[model samples]
Target: MNKSIVAGMLALALAGCASQQPEQPFTLTVAHINDTHSHFDATDARLELGNQALFTRLGGHPRLQSHAESLRRQAEAADQPLLFVHGGDAWQGTGYFKLNQGAMNADILSRMRLDAMALGNHEFDLDNERLAAFIGGVDFPVLAANLDASRDPHLSGLENLRPYVLYEFDGHDKERLESMDDAGDDPVVAVIGLVLEDMAEISPNLGELIFEREVLAAQRTVRALREQEVKHIVAITHLGLERDQRLAKEVNGIDLIVGGHSHSLLGNFSNLGWDQNEPYAQVFTNQDGRGKTCVVQAGQYAQAMGRVSVTFTPDGRVSQCDGGNTLLSDHAFFRDIRRAEQHRLAGQDAARVAAFIEAQPNIALVEEDPALRAHIDEQYKPALDRAYGEVIGHVPVELKHVRLPGADGQGSRVAPLVAASQLYWANTPAVQAVTGRRADFALVGAGGVRNSLEPGELKEGHVSLELLPFANAMSIVSLTGRQVAGLLLEAINGTLPEGAHTGKFPYSAGLRYEFSETSKGRGYLSRIEHLADGRWQKLDPQAGYQVVMTSYNASGNDGWNTLYTAQQVLTDRLDLAFVDGRLTAFPVARLSKASGGGTQVHYINQPLECNAEGVRCNTDAQAFIDYVRDQRPVLTELTPATVTLNRL
Candidate 1:
């Protein structure tokens, strides 16, 4: 053979060997969202930057939709395979979603093309049947690994929806498939969905028709998916970041965990900095134990979208994973409400979405029920109307329950007046005379004053939902003065300075306290004095004295745990007993008979005391007017005056 022929053959063999080598790895992108608690509009007024205020910009559904579209387009143009997924809590919160019962929001989400979502606890706020209707309304799969929806006849039909889904795709950048060496490699991916177990306790209404198991249910599902040769596993969890980190550390087959629930805007897999009470996890690992699983949540509402990109080798493990959270609101910019309003008004003539909602079908009651709802409305509506509209005293102008910083601010008048009224009602001879048989102390939480009245022309028949939206009726409960002070201290300690002064402290008809607004939460109540000896005195926490307060305060609704331990000796009284009745029942032609006629607020110089137990009070007033009306037969009065309001 010739030497030239041998050399040409060797060159041909080398070229063929180089062409047989493996190609570059394929890349995958997962776009996730969670805890979008129906923050459809920009409601939060106080915002700076980087904080939750960023949400105020792109929080709306329209802005969020536009952002998602742009990102999807960008990913497609880049030749990347993008998957859109949601962790859970797609609805509830705010008057918008609550009034509509999630129907409109669900429609918007369906248009958003959410590929998959986990069933959140808020979904059940409308109950089982409505949830079934909502699930049917959405095109995407709502998966919950441990939810046993078998008992709900409306949900049992969805048994085909698996706890996890396995997707096998030809790995290629959607834009430039030809640029990648392993563009045609097929990789199998498993996506599992997990719901928080505590949802059963917190959102009992949503989970009442179903039961949730722990992470073990997810483990079993992952094992099954792995058995089918699906190696790249991603768990869309509604169990929050802590549980997600814990699951990643404990679970063996999970490749990555997309977390939701405890709405933290997580950017990386490290220490969670915002929460101070608990220790942060040092590190979080992926399914392979050695690798790290990227966990993230896009805060609440559709404020932002999570973008995660990971490269995978021919084997079932992940390779270079890189991505960052995108603040979509940066472009939408909802901060300038005036600008948004202009834009929104300009777009009002635009075409509406082409969708139809069928008329609601009503279910007829099978049993003949008594007029319970009517009875409740009839019993409570008048009391609410009188409390909101009736003129308790002769005010120079109208006063409102809430106040803003300005000349028009009347919260001061309303607060002091109401405080004085409750104090007088509790200690009046009639109230004291009935102490052994009924509530001795009357209390009111500040948040209960749902709405405020306007100056001038405030008239009758005005009170409605705005007056008391929470359905929290005024109530009276008996407690010792020591217990009362302890409760107040606890509230003052837990509340912000402003909140402690205006809303945290329980208002009582028999007690008074002088607090400084500049003091920190715990030290806010610098001097607490009760009215006695025609004067005020410092309060002692150990002394026992009878007291009365509102039901919300006594029942521990607003972090008032101290009240719960105060020994509830009495309750179940009409909300208007002391204040409304006193203002209206006064005989005509008398000074106290006129509106604003009851105990007027007058700041005192020192503290006051009352009772044999040496109970004391540190407050702005020395004496509270007693309106007991002889403590015998309960005096009843009816008035025609009422107040009205528009809640928006």
Candidate 2:
């Protein structure tokens, strides 16, 4: 009775076996850069040849152009789809950035022709209007999915930026979709963007614009892309390698993350053999705990451009992922890469391939883009020469400014001196002549100082780029001795971010203090003395004192709210402040505006121009310049620093 049924089942099984279609492999290649940070041209760097060392320039807009074009050609020859992605932070960190305010970067990167980029924290360095202007300029999509910028007039009406973008593969057909046809086989890739969440903490200009958590935003963006039947989601993020690693662990559906902000060297490298950077791309398991995610970053300042090749099964699961950083400082690396690919495709034997690699030149010069080079050479160079070439002063030895281990007491000694420089700015007769009140001490933050100086030369350019790249100006504020003491404690005991040091350590003027780490939380301030009557005596915590600090610190958004004099004056959290600029302590507004029409501590964003403007402001670099030029003949090396817990 079952013979006919068995025969029927056999035929059905054969039909099923014959109808099954093997999974087609989807291949994609992404060439990416992150933390481009406005160092538009290559600078001199130590490069490693096979067995020799050479100092040469590496990376600039032009080299990137030529290399990327070569990469595109290679990808096409290999029959792989190629994408160019940027991970963000193309703002700040150079004289070009200061002079042009990211205009050059926007122009240069646009010329490089990016497909997508995430919004970096530094993009908000300027006002929203400026950021909107930048967004208006980029031809490719500028993406930030965590925040809703539609309500902000400064960011709304921008056509170039969006939450996500869909990039259809080369063979995509519009005719297939227009006919109401069931063409579910379109090769569409979705790229989502994520901006860093700590913008409010790092810079305060974001102002009332709220950012959603990264995981939630990612989930929603992925869901939306899935709804549109888009597979192979790539999250281009400005959240740095550390955050990106956490993201890979937490989020699903993202095949890759091209990241920035920490300026991490991900994957492979060439150079003096920077051995510390992570391999060009790090692989992690997928969210379902089965598939894989590849995370890559192009080192900051365009030192390298990363290329990642990913293969996905037709069902949108990752199959093979290979990536490494291209050290643009040396074109030889890229040439070898091309050669290796050519040989592999040509079926060259391993011995022949190794011989070919050995025969390749160790050093290859990167050709400059002529027109851009001329503009930089003739125009930008001349401008820099005029402004920064002047010898401002000399230093006996290199002023110590390099960041040390977190436990090191002298994290950045020049930072303390930068703090001391503020005293010279505010205590001048100009302030007494105009405001009738002069500042007694000043605060300089260690985090704001960017570079260290060498022993030989001290140009205005040195002060400009190293000391004041951020262009933060002075803010005069009022504080009591207790407030000052509390500020120091805030700097020393502020909550450290994950894998970050406490950057708010105050470098002071006209005062010295001592405290112990063991006794910090129990009672941090052991003794704080100020120079009174030319003698170092106990600082009166109750006595009112005038203080000057950079507006970056005064904004109360530098992750050191307790250091803000307003918090001490009003005894309330910064988040509780209203538009009226008063703190609501115990649900009551207690802050009274100073006589000059600002906060109780008198918030002034302008440079201190006492005679002409009544009040004045001095940028950090300018203050360093004026102080070194006028009072100090030679900047000297640091005296040995006792540990902070011993003496701060």
Q: Write the per-residue lDDT of candidate 2 for residues 1-648, one digit (tens) a residue.
A: 599999999999876643332247778889998877777777445434444343445787677777788777787777667889999988877777777786777777888878888999889877778888888888888988897776777787677778887765653121112111233434667778998776666765664356778988997888777766566788899886778888888887788888887777765344444455677567788678975788888777776778898888877888888867766643333123223444232233434333433453322345666766676676566665666666777766556564322444455657767767777766666534434556766676766776566555578877876457775556566678987787777766663334343455566666777656554232376788776566777878789877777766765545556544355344321111112322111121223323212233332232222223222222567778878788765886434442245421
Please provide, for model 1 over 1-648, each residue's C-alpha lDDT reduced to its tens digit, 9 standing for 90 to 100.
999999999999876643432245657788877877665543222222323221123445555555566667887777666778888877764334534556755676787777678877567545567777777888777778877666556787773244765555543332212112332335556677887664432332342244456567877887776665555777788876667777877777676677677665655422211222222212366466675565656666655567777666655556666555543422222334333444331232221110100111110001111242243235433454454444322223334454212222212334444444455654555544543333333455654443443322223222222322222223344445566767766764554433122345344443555444443433445556665665556566666554544433444545566654443333222221223223111111101111211111111222111111333221111111122122201212111101111111
Q: lDDT per prediction?
A: 0.49, 0.65
Q: Which stretches of candidate 1 lie over 4 Å from their true place?
A: 1-24, 42-56, 159-162, 171-185, 206-210, 268-283, 286-288, 330-648
Regions of model 2 farther than 4 Å from truth: 1-22, 46-54, 171-186, 267-275, 330-365, 378-380, 395-410, 435-440, 454-456, 481-497, 501-545, 563-618, 642-648
List TM-score per model, in order: 0.52, 0.76
Specify the poorest-scoring 10-residue window by lDDT in model 1.
Answer: 356-365
- Residue 403: error of model 2 in Å? 4.8
